[model samples]
Target: MNYSIKVTGLKYTMTIISATELQKNRIKKLVDLLKQCENINQQIENLME
Candidate 1:
């Protein structure tokens, strides 16, 4: 079966598709990691100021 996921971030939004549940879960995990990285970077920038 095919699965679709919508990922939205501060700058943009997009749709992703996967052929299996495992692939979809992996994509979701990666997206979460990216979001965490963005938040950490923003915190660092704020600290610099």
Candidate 2:
């Protein structure tokens, strides 16, 4: 099936597709990793100043 999430303060639509338990967990982990990576990148840029 598919899932949709409405983020706060955003008008865009997010779509996610999954078939089983493993798929859902994997997708969640990927999203978490992406957000962490962004934060770390920002920190690195700030430290270079």
Candidate 3:
């Protein structure tokens, strides 16, 4: 299972939220917000084998 991760920083709000369980009727708005994150967002910069 992938854990839900959310990161926020200065000049940015509710960004980089990689979620596992997206509740009903919230996908659109939530996804829009997620896109706000830039390089300051969470998650690995690159994935390797």
Question: What TM-score goes with each of the models?
Answer: 0.65, 0.58, 0.25
Q: Write the per-residue lDDT of candidate 2 for residues 1-49, one digit (tens) a residue.
A: 3333323323333356535788778876766665666667777879998
Better of 1 and 2 by lDDT: 1
The list of candidate 2 runs beyond 4 A from truth reads 1-14
TM-score of 1: 0.65
Pick the lDDT winner. 1
**Rank order (by lDDT, best first):** 1, 2, 3
Candidate no. 3 TM-score: 0.25
Q: Candidate 3: which pairs clash?
A: none
Query: What Cα-based lDDT does every candidate model obtain?
Result: 0.61, 0.57, 0.43
Error of 1 at 15 (Å): 3.7
